[model samples]
Target: MTREEREQLLARYTTGELTPLERERLFTEAMNDQELFEHLFEDDALEEALSDPAVRRHIMNTAPAPAPAWPLRWRWPVLAGLAASLVLAVILIQRQLTPSSDRSDEHTSELPSPCLLLSPL
Candidate 1:
Protein backbone atom coordinates (compact mmCIF):
# COMPACT_ATOMS: atom_id res chain seq x y z
CA MET A 1 0.00 0.00 0.00
CA THR A 2 1.00 3.61 -0.54
CA ARG A 3 2.31 5.69 2.34
CA GLU A 4 -1.05 7.47 2.74
CA GLU A 5 -2.97 4.19 2.76
CA ARG A 6 -0.49 2.70 5.21
CA GLU A 7 -0.84 5.73 7.47
CA GLN A 8 -4.63 5.40 7.42
CA LEU A 9 -4.36 1.69 8.19
CA LEU A 10 -1.88 2.40 10.97
CA ALA A 11 -4.27 4.94 12.50
CA ARG A 12 -7.13 2.47 12.36
CA TYR A 13 -4.97 -0.32 13.75
CA THR A 14 -3.77 1.84 16.62
CA THR A 15 -7.34 2.85 17.44
CA GLY A 16 -8.65 -0.75 17.20
CA GLU A 17 -10.92 0.31 14.35
CA LEU A 18 -9.19 -1.75 11.66
CA THR A 19 -10.73 -4.95 10.31
CA PRO A 20 -8.74 -8.17 10.84
CA LEU A 21 -7.45 -8.14 7.27
CA GLU A 22 -6.48 -4.49 7.52
CA ARG A 23 -4.60 -5.16 10.73
CA GLU A 24 -2.75 -8.04 9.07
CA ARG A 25 -1.75 -5.80 6.18
CA LEU A 26 -0.59 -3.05 8.58
CA PHE A 27 1.63 -5.45 10.57
CA THR A 28 3.01 -6.98 7.39
CA GLU A 29 3.88 -3.59 5.96
CA ALA A 30 5.43 -2.43 9.24
CA MET A 31 7.59 -5.54 9.40
CA ASN A 32 8.80 -5.09 5.83
CA ASP A 33 9.49 -1.34 6.22
CA GLN A 34 12.03 -0.38 8.86
CA GLU A 35 11.44 3.34 8.24
CA LEU A 36 7.71 2.91 8.82
CA PHE A 37 8.34 1.11 12.09
CA GLU A 38 10.46 4.06 13.23
CA HIS A 39 7.86 6.48 11.88
CA LEU A 40 5.14 4.95 14.05
CA PHE A 41 6.76 6.56 17.08
CA GLU A 42 8.31 9.52 15.27
CA ASP A 43 6.14 12.10 17.01
CA ASP A 44 5.58 10.29 20.33
CA ALA A 45 7.81 10.68 23.43
CA LEU A 46 8.75 7.00 23.07
CA GLU A 47 11.29 7.91 20.38
CA GLU A 48 12.99 10.76 22.26
CA ALA A 49 12.73 9.56 25.83
CA LEU A 50 12.95 5.84 25.24
CA SER A 51 16.41 5.68 26.86
CA ASP A 52 15.12 7.07 30.17
CA PRO A 53 14.19 4.50 32.82
CA ALA A 54 11.09 6.44 33.87
CA VAL A 55 9.88 6.69 30.28
CA ARG A 56 10.48 2.99 29.67
CA ARG A 57 8.69 2.12 32.90
CA HIS A 58 5.73 4.37 31.99
CA ILE A 59 5.59 2.86 28.51
CA MET A 60 5.49 -0.61 29.97
CA ASN A 61 2.77 0.41 32.43
CA THR A 62 0.62 2.44 30.02
CA ALA A 63 0.47 -0.01 27.15
CA PRO A 64 -2.99 -0.38 25.62
CA ALA A 65 -5.14 -2.63 27.82
CA PRO A 66 -7.36 -5.43 26.58
CA ALA A 67 -11.09 -4.90 26.06
CA PRO A 68 -13.26 -5.59 29.10
CA ALA A 69 -15.61 -8.55 28.97
CA TRP A 70 -19.35 -7.90 29.35
CA PRO A 71 -21.30 -10.03 31.80
CA LEU A 72 -24.31 -10.44 29.51
CA ARG A 73 -24.32 -9.40 25.86
CA TRP A 74 -28.10 -9.60 25.66
CA ARG A 75 -28.67 -7.29 28.62
CA TRP A 76 -29.19 -4.20 26.49
CA PRO A 77 -31.51 -5.99 24.09
CA VAL A 78 -33.54 -7.41 26.95
CA LEU A 79 -33.90 -3.99 28.57
CA ALA A 80 -34.92 -2.40 25.27
CA GLY A 81 -37.53 -5.11 24.69
CA LEU A 82 -38.87 -4.61 28.21
CA ALA A 83 -39.09 -0.84 27.74
CA ALA A 84 -40.94 -1.28 24.44
CA SER A 85 -43.39 -3.76 26.02
CA LEU A 86 -44.04 -1.38 28.90
CA VAL A 87 -44.76 1.49 26.50
CA LEU A 88 -47.07 -0.70 24.46
CA ALA A 89 -48.88 -1.85 27.58
CA VAL A 90 -49.26 1.73 28.81
CA ILE A 91 -50.74 2.76 25.45
CA LEU A 92 -53.15 -0.16 25.48
CA ILE A 93 -54.28 0.64 29.04
CA GLN A 94 -54.76 4.30 28.23
CA ARG A 95 -56.87 3.44 25.18
CA GLN A 96 -58.97 1.07 27.24
CA LEU A 97 -59.45 3.56 30.07
CA THR A 98 -60.51 6.38 27.76
CA PRO A 99 -64.18 5.65 26.99
CA SER A 100 -64.83 5.28 23.25
CA SER A 101 -67.89 6.50 21.32
CA ASP A 102 -68.99 2.88 21.01
CA ARG A 103 -69.49 2.90 24.83
CA SER A 104 -71.52 6.14 24.76
CA ASP A 105 -74.70 4.19 25.51
CA GLU A 106 -73.38 3.28 28.96
CA HIS A 107 -72.33 6.92 29.69
CA THR A 108 -75.66 8.39 28.44
CA SER A 109 -77.58 6.75 31.31
CA GLU A 110 -75.64 8.62 34.02
CA LEU A 111 -74.65 11.79 32.05
CA PRO A 112 -77.61 12.72 29.85
CA SER A 113 -76.95 14.99 26.76
CA PRO A 114 -77.72 18.70 27.10
CA CYS A 115 -80.38 18.47 24.34
CA LEU A 116 -82.17 15.67 26.25
CA LEU A 117 -82.05 17.64 29.54
CA LEU A 118 -83.23 20.88 27.89
CA SER A 119 -86.22 19.13 26.24
CA PRO A 120 -87.92 18.69 29.66
CA LEU A 121 -87.01 22.21 30.88
Candidate 2:
Protein backbone atom coordinates (compact mmCIF):
# COMPACT_ATOMS: atom_id res chain seq x y z
CA MET A 1 0.00 0.00 0.00
CA THR A 2 1.08 3.60 -0.55
CA ARG A 3 2.21 5.62 2.50
CA GLU A 4 -1.07 7.60 2.48
CA GLU A 5 -3.20 4.39 2.37
CA ARG A 6 -1.12 2.93 5.21
CA GLU A 7 -1.61 6.11 7.26
CA GLN A 8 -5.40 6.02 6.61
CA LEU A 9 -5.60 2.44 7.83
CA LEU A 10 -3.69 3.39 10.98
CA ALA A 11 -6.04 6.29 11.56
CA ARG A 12 -9.09 3.99 11.29
CA TYR A 13 -7.50 1.63 13.81
CA THR A 14 -6.76 4.52 16.15
CA THR A 15 -10.41 5.53 16.14
CA GLY A 16 -11.51 1.87 16.65
CA GLU A 17 -13.41 1.99 13.34
CA LEU A 18 -11.80 -1.07 11.70
CA THR A 19 -13.59 -4.40 11.18
CA PRO A 20 -12.11 -7.55 12.76
CA LEU A 21 -10.63 -8.54 9.35
CA GLU A 22 -9.06 -5.11 8.90
CA ARG A 23 -7.65 -5.20 12.41
CA GLU A 24 -6.17 -8.69 11.79
CA ARG A 25 -4.63 -7.55 8.52
CA LEU A 26 -3.13 -4.43 10.18
CA PHE A 27 -1.67 -6.48 13.03
CA THR A 28 -0.25 -9.12 10.71
CA GLU A 29 1.35 -6.47 8.55
CA ALA A 30 2.61 -4.54 11.58
CA MET A 31 4.28 -7.71 12.93
CA ASN A 32 6.49 -7.78 9.84
CA ASP A 33 6.93 -4.03 9.30
CA GLN A 34 8.99 -2.22 11.96
CA GLU A 35 8.04 1.18 10.49
CA LEU A 36 4.28 0.39 10.69
CA PHE A 37 4.66 -0.86 14.26
CA GLU A 38 6.44 2.37 15.15
CA HIS A 39 3.62 4.39 13.59
CA LEU A 40 0.95 2.59 15.65
CA PHE A 41 3.08 2.88 18.77
CA GLU A 42 3.30 6.67 18.36
CA ASP A 43 -0.44 7.09 17.80
CA ASP A 44 -2.41 8.70 20.68
CA ALA A 45 -5.27 6.19 20.59
CA LEU A 46 -4.86 5.07 24.23
CA GLU A 47 -4.86 8.70 25.35
CA GLU A 48 -8.04 9.35 23.36
CA ALA A 49 -9.75 6.29 24.80
CA LEU A 50 -8.86 7.24 28.35
CA SER A 51 -10.10 10.79 27.76
CA ASP A 52 -13.49 9.55 26.53
CA PRO A 53 -16.32 10.19 29.06
CA ALA A 54 -17.78 6.71 28.65
CA VAL A 55 -14.44 5.17 29.63
CA ARG A 56 -14.19 7.53 32.61
CA ARG A 57 -17.74 6.61 33.71
CA HIS A 58 -16.98 2.92 33.39
CA ILE A 59 -13.88 3.33 35.55
CA MET A 60 -15.82 5.28 38.18
CA ASN A 61 -18.64 2.71 38.32
CA THR A 62 -16.23 -0.21 38.66
CA ALA A 63 -13.93 1.41 41.22
CA PRO A 64 -14.67 1.10 44.97
CA ALA A 65 -16.95 3.81 46.33
CA PRO A 66 -15.25 6.59 48.26
CA ALA A 67 -15.73 6.91 52.02
CA PRO A 68 -19.13 8.33 52.96
CA ALA A 69 -19.36 12.06 53.85
CA TRP A 70 -22.16 11.58 56.39
CA PRO A 71 -19.96 12.70 59.27
CA LEU A 72 -18.45 15.59 57.31
CA ARG A 73 -21.84 17.19 56.67
CA TRP A 74 -22.64 17.06 60.40
CA ARG A 75 -19.15 18.14 61.53
CA TRP A 76 -19.91 21.84 61.90
CA PRO A 77 -23.09 21.31 63.89
CA VAL A 78 -21.48 18.75 66.16
CA LEU A 79 -18.54 21.03 66.83
CA ALA A 80 -20.89 23.91 67.54
CA GLY A 81 -22.91 21.82 69.97
CA LEU A 82 -19.72 20.64 71.71
CA ALA A 83 -18.47 24.23 71.98
CA ALA A 84 -21.80 25.42 73.40
CA SER A 85 -21.85 22.57 75.89
CA LEU A 86 -18.27 23.35 76.97
CA VAL A 87 -19.15 27.00 77.51
CA LEU A 88 -22.28 26.09 79.48
CA ALA A 89 -20.28 23.68 81.65
CA VAL A 90 -17.67 26.35 82.30
CA ILE A 91 -20.37 28.85 83.28
CA LEU A 92 -22.01 26.36 85.63
CA ILE A 93 -18.67 25.50 87.23
CA GLN A 94 -17.94 29.18 87.77
CA ARG A 95 -21.38 29.73 89.29
CA GLN A 96 -20.88 26.86 91.70
CA LEU A 97 -17.37 28.03 92.67
CA THR A 98 -18.30 31.69 93.36
CA PRO A 99 -20.62 31.89 96.35
CA SER A 100 -23.39 34.51 96.02
CA SER A 101 -23.58 37.05 98.92
CA ASP A 102 -27.11 38.29 98.03
CA ARG A 103 -29.51 37.76 100.97
CA SER A 104 -28.41 34.31 102.05
CA ASP A 105 -29.13 33.34 105.67
CA GLU A 106 -31.93 35.89 106.43
CA HIS A 107 -33.98 35.05 103.35
CA THR A 108 -33.44 31.26 103.59
CA SER A 109 -34.59 31.18 107.29
CA GLU A 110 -38.05 32.67 106.45
CA LEU A 111 -38.98 30.05 103.80
CA PRO A 112 -40.42 26.64 104.84
CA SER A 113 -38.70 23.57 103.38
CA PRO A 114 -40.45 21.98 100.37
CA CYS A 115 -40.38 18.53 102.06
CA LEU A 116 -42.47 19.86 105.04
CA LEU A 117 -44.86 21.66 102.65
CA LEU A 118 -45.41 18.56 100.51
CA SER A 119 -45.82 16.11 103.48
CA PRO A 120 -49.25 14.60 104.10
CA LEU A 121 -51.18 16.44 106.82
Candidate 3:
Protein backbone atom coordinates (compact mmCIF):
# COMPACT_ATOMS: atom_id res chain seq x y z
CA MET A 1 0.00 0.00 0.00
CA THR A 2 1.05 3.59 -0.61
CA ARG A 3 2.31 5.61 2.40
CA GLU A 4 -0.52 8.13 2.15
CA GLU A 5 -3.20 5.42 1.99
CA ARG A 6 -1.68 3.62 5.00
CA GLU A 7 -1.61 6.88 6.97
CA GLN A 8 -5.26 7.68 6.16
CA LEU A 9 -6.31 4.15 7.17
CA LEU A 10 -4.32 4.48 10.40
CA ALA A 11 -6.07 7.78 11.22
CA ARG A 12 -9.47 6.19 10.72
CA TYR A 13 -8.47 3.16 12.80
CA THR A 14 -7.33 5.37 15.65
CA THR A 15 -10.61 7.29 15.61
CA GLY A 16 -12.82 4.12 15.72
CA GLU A 17 -14.12 5.09 12.29
CA LEU A 18 -12.74 2.21 10.17
CA THR A 19 -15.05 -0.33 8.53
CA PRO A 20 -14.30 -4.00 9.32
CA LEU A 21 -12.58 -4.53 5.95
CA GLU A 22 -10.38 -1.45 6.41
CA ARG A 23 -9.49 -2.54 9.92
CA GLU A 24 -8.52 -6.00 8.62
CA ARG A 25 -6.45 -4.50 5.81
CA LEU A 26 -4.67 -2.17 8.28
CA PHE A 27 -3.90 -5.12 10.56
CA THR A 28 -2.51 -7.09 7.61
CA GLU A 29 -0.29 -4.16 6.69
CA ALA A 30 0.76 -3.72 10.33
CA MET A 31 1.99 -7.35 10.30
CA ASN A 32 4.43 -6.40 7.52
CA ASP A 33 5.42 -2.97 8.88
CA GLN A 34 6.86 -3.16 12.42
CA GLU A 35 7.31 0.63 12.72
CA LEU A 36 3.73 1.27 11.64
CA PHE A 37 2.45 -1.34 14.13
CA GLU A 38 4.39 0.29 16.98
CA HIS A 39 2.96 3.71 16.10
CA LEU A 40 -0.58 2.32 15.99
CA PHE A 41 -0.03 0.59 19.33
CA GLU A 42 1.17 3.88 20.87
CA ASP A 43 -1.82 5.76 19.45
CA ASP A 44 -4.21 3.17 20.89
CA ALA A 45 -2.50 3.43 24.27
CA LEU A 46 -2.73 7.24 24.18
CA GLU A 47 -6.41 7.10 23.27
CA GLU A 48 -7.09 4.70 26.15
CA ALA A 49 -5.19 6.96 28.55
CA LEU A 50 -7.16 10.03 27.45
CA SER A 51 -10.48 8.22 27.79
CA ASP A 52 -9.78 7.52 31.46
CA PRO A 53 -10.45 10.54 33.72
CA ALA A 54 -8.13 9.19 36.48
CA VAL A 55 -5.14 8.86 34.16
CA ARG A 56 -5.71 12.38 32.78
CA ARG A 57 -5.94 13.83 36.31
CA HIS A 58 -2.75 12.06 37.45
CA ILE A 59 -0.80 13.28 34.38
CA MET A 60 -1.91 16.88 35.00
CA ASN A 61 -1.07 16.68 38.72
CA THR A 62 2.44 15.24 38.19
CA ALA A 63 3.49 17.47 35.28
CA PRO A 64 6.82 19.21 35.83
CA ALA A 65 7.00 22.96 36.43
CA PRO A 66 8.52 25.06 33.64
CA ALA A 67 12.18 26.06 33.95
CA PRO A 68 12.92 29.62 35.04
CA ALA A 69 14.57 31.91 32.47
CA TRP A 70 18.34 32.42 32.74
CA PRO A 71 20.65 34.96 31.08
CA LEU A 72 22.25 33.84 27.79
CA ARG A 73 25.81 33.98 29.18
CA TRP A 74 24.91 31.83 32.22
CA ARG A 75 22.89 29.36 30.14
CA TRP A 76 25.64 28.82 27.54
CA PRO A 77 28.37 28.18 30.14
CA VAL A 78 26.19 25.76 32.12
CA LEU A 79 25.08 23.92 28.98
CA ALA A 80 28.65 23.62 27.72
CA GLY A 81 29.83 22.27 31.07
CA LEU A 82 27.02 19.69 31.12
CA ALA A 83 27.76 18.60 27.53
CA ALA A 84 31.49 18.21 28.29
CA SER A 85 30.77 16.21 31.43
CA LEU A 86 28.38 13.94 29.51
CA VAL A 87 31.00 13.31 26.82
CA LEU A 88 33.65 12.53 29.46
CA ALA A 89 31.28 10.12 31.22
CA VAL A 90 30.49 8.28 27.97
CA ILE A 91 34.20 7.95 27.11
CA LEU A 92 35.02 6.64 30.58
CA ILE A 93 32.17 4.12 30.45
CA GLN A 94 33.18 2.93 27.00
CA ARG A 95 36.80 2.47 28.10
CA GLN A 96 35.71 0.51 31.14
CA LEU A 97 33.40 -1.79 29.19
CA THR A 98 35.79 -2.46 26.25
CA PRO A 99 38.38 -5.14 27.05
CA SER A 100 42.01 -4.08 26.52
CA SER A 101 44.83 -6.53 27.52
CA ASP A 102 46.51 -4.00 29.91
CA ARG A 103 43.28 -2.81 31.53
CA SER A 104 42.00 -6.38 31.98
CA ASP A 105 45.27 -7.45 33.68
CA GLU A 106 45.13 -4.43 36.03
CA HIS A 107 41.55 -5.26 36.98
CA THR A 108 42.22 -9.00 37.46
CA SER A 109 45.68 -8.94 39.19
CA GLU A 110 46.04 -9.09 42.97
CA LEU A 111 48.38 -6.72 44.84
CA PRO A 112 51.77 -8.14 45.90
CA SER A 113 52.43 -8.53 49.64
CA PRO A 114 54.44 -5.80 51.45
CA CYS A 115 56.33 -8.52 53.41
CA LEU A 116 57.54 -10.16 50.14
CA LEU A 117 58.88 -6.79 48.90
CA LEU A 118 60.56 -6.05 52.29
CA SER A 119 62.32 -9.47 52.33
CA PRO A 120 63.75 -8.79 48.82
CA LEU A 121 64.93 -5.37 50.03
Candidate 4:
Protein backbone atom coordinates (compact mmCIF):
# COMPACT_ATOMS: atom_id res chain seq x y z
CA MET A 1 0.00 0.00 0.00
CA THR A 2 1.11 3.55 -0.73
CA ARG A 3 1.93 5.96 2.07
CA GLU A 4 -1.42 7.68 1.54
CA GLU A 5 -3.28 4.35 1.71
CA ARG A 6 -1.40 3.43 4.87
CA GLU A 7 -2.27 6.77 6.44
CA GLN A 8 -5.93 6.39 5.52
CA LEU A 9 -6.08 2.88 6.96
CA LEU A 10 -4.48 4.04 10.17
CA ALA A 11 -6.90 6.94 10.37
CA ARG A 12 -9.90 4.62 10.03
CA TYR A 13 -8.41 2.22 12.57
CA THR A 14 -7.90 4.97 15.16
CA THR A 15 -11.54 6.01 14.77
CA GLY A 16 -12.80 2.41 15.26
CA GLU A 17 -14.46 2.66 11.85
CA LEU A 18 -12.67 -0.23 10.18
CA THR A 19 -14.69 -3.35 9.38
CA PRO A 20 -13.52 -6.70 10.78
CA LEU A 21 -12.10 -7.74 7.42
CA GLU A 22 -10.35 -4.40 7.04
CA ARG A 23 -9.00 -4.69 10.56
CA GLU A 24 -7.72 -8.21 9.89
CA ARG A 25 -6.13 -7.09 6.64
CA LEU A 26 -4.50 -4.16 8.36
CA PHE A 27 -3.08 -6.43 11.05
CA THR A 28 -1.87 -8.99 8.53
CA GLU A 29 -0.29 -6.28 6.42
CA ALA A 30 1.29 -4.69 9.47
CA MET A 31 2.85 -8.02 10.30
CA ASN A 32 4.15 -8.52 6.77
CA ASP A 33 4.90 -4.92 5.76
CA GLN A 34 7.67 -3.31 7.80
CA GLU A 35 6.83 0.25 6.74
CA LEU A 36 3.17 -0.07 7.68
CA PHE A 37 4.15 -1.60 11.04
CA GLU A 38 6.52 1.29 11.90
CA HIS A 39 3.91 3.81 10.82
CA LEU A 40 1.57 2.29 13.42
CA PHE A 41 3.84 3.15 16.35
CA GLU A 42 5.49 6.24 14.76
CA ASP A 43 8.71 5.48 16.66
CA ASP A 44 6.86 5.75 20.00
CA ALA A 45 7.18 3.03 22.64
CA LEU A 46 4.30 0.49 22.71
CA GLU A 47 3.70 1.44 26.33
CA GLU A 48 3.50 5.12 25.44
CA ALA A 49 0.90 4.52 22.74
CA LEU A 50 -1.19 2.30 25.03
CA SER A 51 -1.00 4.79 27.88
CA ASP A 52 -3.09 7.27 25.88
CA PRO A 53 -6.71 6.63 26.84
CA ALA A 54 -7.96 7.59 23.41
CA VAL A 55 -5.58 5.15 21.77
CA ARG A 56 -6.54 2.41 24.25
CA ARG A 57 -10.23 3.03 23.71
CA HIS A 58 -9.86 3.01 19.96
CA ILE A 59 -7.97 -0.26 20.09
CA MET A 60 -10.51 -1.81 22.40
CA ASN A 61 -13.39 -0.71 20.22
CA THR A 62 -11.74 -2.07 17.10
CA ALA A 63 -11.11 -5.55 18.58
CA PRO A 64 -13.54 -8.42 18.22
CA ALA A 65 -16.17 -8.87 20.93
CA PRO A 66 -15.50 -11.79 23.25
CA ALA A 67 -17.80 -14.81 23.43
CA PRO A 68 -19.95 -15.27 26.53
CA ALA A 69 -18.58 -17.64 29.20
CA TRP A 70 -21.71 -19.78 29.08
CA PRO A 71 -25.36 -19.72 28.10
CA LEU A 72 -27.82 -17.78 30.30
CA ARG A 73 -29.96 -20.93 30.67
CA TRP A 74 -27.24 -22.54 32.80
CA ARG A 75 -26.52 -19.51 34.97
CA TRP A 76 -29.51 -19.69 37.32
CA PRO A 77 -29.21 -23.43 37.91
CA VAL A 78 -25.51 -23.08 38.82
CA LEU A 79 -26.24 -20.21 41.21
CA ALA A 80 -29.04 -22.16 42.86
CA GLY A 81 -26.74 -25.17 43.31
CA LEU A 82 -24.11 -22.97 44.95
CA ALA A 83 -26.73 -21.49 47.31
CA ALA A 84 -27.98 -24.93 48.27
CA SER A 85 -24.43 -26.09 49.04
CA LEU A 86 -23.88 -22.99 51.18
CA VAL A 87 -27.06 -23.70 53.21
CA LEU A 88 -26.04 -27.30 53.71
CA ALA A 89 -22.57 -26.18 54.89
CA VAL A 90 -24.10 -23.74 57.41
CA ILE A 91 -26.47 -26.40 58.79
CA LEU A 92 -23.63 -28.92 59.23
CA ILE A 93 -21.49 -26.29 60.97
CA GLN A 94 -24.32 -25.36 63.34
CA ARG A 95 -24.92 -29.01 64.24
CA GLN A 96 -21.24 -29.50 65.06
CA LEU A 97 -21.15 -26.37 67.25
CA THR A 98 -24.35 -27.21 69.25
CA PRO A 99 -23.89 -29.12 72.50
CA SER A 100 -25.76 -32.46 72.06
CA SER A 101 -27.69 -33.83 75.06
CA ASP A 102 -26.62 -37.40 74.16
CA ARG A 103 -23.00 -36.71 75.35
CA SER A 104 -22.51 -35.45 78.93
CA ASP A 105 -20.39 -32.30 79.44
CA GLU A 106 -18.64 -34.14 82.26
CA HIS A 107 -17.66 -36.98 79.92
CA THR A 108 -16.13 -34.51 77.44
CA SER A 109 -14.39 -32.49 80.20
CA GLU A 110 -12.76 -35.57 81.84
CA LEU A 111 -11.11 -36.76 78.57
CA PRO A 112 -7.25 -36.70 78.66
CA SER A 113 -5.62 -33.77 76.87
CA PRO A 114 -4.61 -34.48 73.23
CA CYS A 115 -1.02 -33.52 74.13
CA LEU A 116 -0.98 -36.14 76.93
CA LEU A 117 -2.25 -38.79 74.47
CA LEU A 118 0.57 -37.92 72.05
CA SER A 119 3.35 -37.81 74.71
CA PRO A 120 4.71 -40.60 77.00
CA LEU A 121 2.44 -41.43 79.92
If scored against the real structure, what TM-score would every candidate get?
0.32, 0.34, 0.52, 0.32
lDDT string for model 1 (1-121, tens) is: 8989998887776566988888778778878899877766563445469868898999899999876576478789989999999999999999999988868877788885566445654
Estimate the TM-score for candidate 4: 0.32
Specify the poorest-scoring 10-residue window by lDDT in model 1: 112-121
What lDDT does candidate 4 reach at residue 54? 100
**TM-score of candidate 2 versus the correct structure, residues matched by position:** 0.34
Poorest 10 consecutive residues by lDDT, candidate 3: 112-121
Stretches off by above 4 angstroms in model 3 are 67-121
For model 4, residues 33-116, the per-residue Cα lDDT tens digits are 887788766734675889899999999999998878898899999999999999999999998999787667778888887763
Better of 2 and 3 by TM-score: 3
By how many angstroms RMSD does model 2 differ from the true structure?
14.5
Give Cα-based local distance difference scores for all models.
Answer: 0.79, 0.83, 0.89, 0.82
lDDT of 2 by residue, 1-121 (tens): 6667677789899888999988888888888889898777767666778789999889789999789867688989999999999999999999888877765777888898776446666
Weakest lDDT window of 10 consecutive positions for candidate 2: 112-121
What tens digits encode model 3's per-residue C-alpha lDDT throughout 25-74? Answer: 99899999999999989898998998899999999999998777776679
Evaluation by lDDT, superior candidate among 1 and 2: 2
- Which wins on lDDT, candidate 1 or candidate 3? 3
Deviation from native of the Cα of residue 82 in model 1, angstroms: 72
